[model samples]
Target: MSKLEIDFCGVKFRNPTVLASGVLGVTASSLKNVVKNGAGGVTTKSIWLKEHAGHKSPVMFGTDHYFMNAVGLSDAGIEKAEKETFPEYSKGGRPAPIIANIVAGKIADFGKLAERVSKLDPDIIEVNISCPNVEDELGKPFACSVVDAAAVTKLVRSKTKKPVIVKLSPNVSNIGEIAKACAGAGADGFCAINTVGPGMAIDINLRKSILSNRVGGLSGPAIKPVAVRCVYDIYKATGLPIIGTGGILTGEDAIEMMMAGARLVGMGTMVYYREVEGFGKVVSEMEEWCRKNGVKNVEEIVACIS
Candidate 1:
């Protein structure tokens, strides 16, 4: 088999297929299932400093081409993560490489959450300053402002010994600039192109919105091109390792992401569109493509486009 192993900020992903945060990522049991089914890594759903009641239901809607939700970063909080998830995830013989995804309302809160979770020694710490749906409480996403992005990234990095990956928003006007700011703040890597939105769907018959939040992030195949472009731009600007996400439904889509400069490709909606084991199937297809194309080290393809 062609070698698919790639290292991102010192962590080795068995393959580039990672379970993106938010799909089946609430508890250890669910996360373990993805790892067992052959995900290279798994990110937990973004946890806030405290429990958050998210937006009212009718929170999701989807069709053949796209998926949307304003989950509002609803989470069980870090205490549960420390008590329930990480310990269980750490015990098993097949310990999944966990990337602890964290979100915050204040700049200092990012550091506090990182400090607390850093004790668990997760393989990585992903600061989610990019979540669009929580703007009502969190104000504008930190990702939209280079200064705020830097402050959050810097704070989180200062608090964690683990590799720090700053998740960037696709909603920004210049994602590359924000990425560069995060990089300067000592971000070890980036998770480019969080769901694209404030976009929406209509319920029509009810003469109302499909999702209760009215507007939500647009994900699935609809955002893949934008993801590829964001990854490509971030690579050109920062040259940082990246987990390219958004609309990765097939091995070909993942490969496209790699060529656009992703060291790892995140699979969320694909798991929904296919199944949890869909990660393994995607990796297999990637290897098959690599073999046919005479690609040896899969890393050779990263940023091949520019």
Candidate 2:
């Protein structure tokens, strides 16, 4: 059998295939189901300090090749995960290590949330600094500024002993500088890139935008190239462990991100389309490709572009 094991930021994963945070990770039942179906790791949906009902209906709209959603960081809150949900996973022989993704409106809130969730004993805490769907008076997403990204990450790092991975927004003009700033502030790793622009699609008939928020972050194959470039750039800049996500639908797609310097690859939009079992199929195909190329280990392919 092909060895898919990879060590990312001191945590060992059976393979590099992790389920990205979002709808796929909202509930414990769904997380167990995906683990049973074969994800190496699963990141919980982006939780906040308090519960959020999220946006109303029409938050998601489908396109021919991708999707746009403005979920507004709706989650069950960090305390629930720390006190109740995580215990369930701990009881069962967890199919894989869990990474908790979290977000907060204020910088200090990041530290408080991180401190609470750290007690849950997850393998990693992913600081969600790049959620483009939520907007304030800032004119751009919260993570669009390097200072905000670094400050939040720094505060969270001070509160947790666990590995801290900052997820970056692709909407930013200078992703590399933002990434370096996070690393300097004590982030152990990074996940690039979050969904692309807060793009809009209007309903010609209704004369209104499709999503409830009027604009939403885009994901799926349409944004893969942009994601790939972001990962490659950050990899070149920070040399930190990267979890690459965005537009990965097939084994080849996953491999593309790995070659762009992602230590681990996250599958999101594809899961919504193919369901959980699709992860196994992608792993199998990746194994075959590895054997054909005489690659003994998956890590050898990181940044191996010719």
Candidate 3:
């Protein structure tokens, strides 16, 4: 068996590096390209029930320390997934596992999106109740309230037989409590520490907020500490598998996340820092680290810190 190979929620992954949702838009060809570049799996961008016109352009900007965006979860909806994305992805026998990420503005809509996306039969279903950009319209993310998070989890769980992994937010006070609620409601696993903050940046010269949306979630190398802490907390709270994400830019960062109890490392902003080939690069780096440490399996490091 490969040192990096892992079974997450009954699904086998060639490696633990997965393309986080929202980096590259959901296109079958683009996703396939990422896999070819060496990602063990790919997650679709947040899929709404109907086409969503996200915030107008100027939605993103970045620096060496951080990346921020207020893209607002725009998507072409489930119709596109059923008719175009999934069909095209399956055309070539699917190079890697696909995690279908479904989102909605309402709890009921969550169930509807789950049901429809599940029928398309992606390898796993990620329920995105934590997008921070749309708080103005949606009135705060569902991940903030344990009761509401559980509600969404229960509804989505009932709608699909596929593994249901809830994407969590880092903006909360006690992420572990929220995670426990979801676990009780039947969540199969979790993707912890979504972008941190609905933060903003101002162009000193322009004298105004950078993004058109004014505020956005923070990503890139800056948030790795927060990601590690959240992953550690969630693991201690539930011992469920986690996809640790946020500010992961190197293979060492991936190994650090695994030591915090993440079964897989989710990366999005790394694409911005290292390009698509970063996946293979990080995987190779991980292997080298393992060999140097005399570790036989990558899984051996999971939660080793505690």
Candidate 4:
């Protein structure tokens, strides 16, 4: 009722609430449930050129206010998703626009994966160079460097006609520079900031780290401020449409990201906490707040902070 539609880089969503990759998107049924519950869009779990078994068990450790995960981009691969998952979701009456989240260790892998998934006709393809749990020679993830980020993004863009959104890593010295490079490399948009840290939690009595990987990426409310800063910086640098993610747990949190310059806000840990219907609840609350404040459309509030 509040005209919640948001258009970004020629792609439009019924609203700004999207299910972030790796939360409820591991399978077709799970993704369909999120859409049925009112997700404006859904980003499938980050897929790779080849299937990965992912990290071991105890991959997730919970903190009082957030979560740390080392899921390691475990996916069924692009070919399987195109053959199995996408067909089911596409046939669902309530299916939301889908964005295929893809990751790879090499530039050629990124291009091949993007080209393959682009045929599935997803609304967008998010190149995931930002996964923090993996090991890379650059010391940080590939998304941390402007050169690597641009290389992956440009390669993918060259192979696909679908809009490409480069998901940026927060574990970087100059996020704005990387963002600018991605935009210049023909990226249609950006999704910031993937997990705030390769943080760790330890069991002092057991003398062991809580997560199997020992270091995991932090998500949820604890990382919200960091995500806001990344979105703000990138917004200032490139003016690209951003899918803000990280620590969104409520409608107010989503609004904060949008006001900080995100065209769409992704909800991950919140959905893990609230389940499928959580998306509708958040959207309803946002609508109420907008109506009472005499807001016309959500986009009018982007970067409204002063």
Candidate lDDT scores, in order, read: 0.90, 0.86, 0.92, 0.86
The digit string of per-residue lDDT tens for model 1 on 1-306 reads 799998989998899989998888989999999988889999999988899888998877678999998988889899999999898888745455789999988999999999999998889999898887877777889999999999999888888789999999988888899999999999999998788877878878999987888888889998999999999999999999999999999989999999999999998889768888898899899999999999998999999989
Estimate TM-scores for all models: 0.98, 0.96, 0.98, 0.96
Q: Please identify model 1 stretches exceeding 4 Å from their true place.
A: none
What is residue 230's positional error in candidate 3, in angstroms? 0.2
Compute the lDDT for candidate 1.
0.90
How well is each residue in 1-306 modelled by candidate 2, as lDDT tens digits? 667889999999888889999967777778888777778889999988898778876888666688898887788787788776788777756778899898887788888989889888889999987888877422465568888888988898999999999999998788999999999999999998888888999999999888888888999889999999999989988999999999998888888999999989998888767778978877887888888888899999998772
- Please tell me which predicted candidate would have the highest lDDT against the true structure: 3
| Winner by lDDT between candidate 4 and candidate 2 | 4
Report the C-alpha lDDT of model 4 over 32-119, residue by residue, as the tens digit: 8897888899999999887887788689866669999998778777778888888888873536788899888777888888888988
lDDT of 3 at 288: 91
Show the lowest summed lDDT stretch of 10 residues, model 2.
134-143
lDDT of 3 by residue, 1-306 (tens): 238898899999999999999988569899999999999999999889999989987988789899999998888888999999999999959898999998998999999888888889889999999999999889989999999999999999999999999999999999999999999999999998888998999999999998888899999999999999999999998899999998888889999999999999999999988999999999999989998999888889999998
What is the lDDT ranking, best to worst?
3, 1, 4, 2
Clash list (residue pairs), candidate 1: none
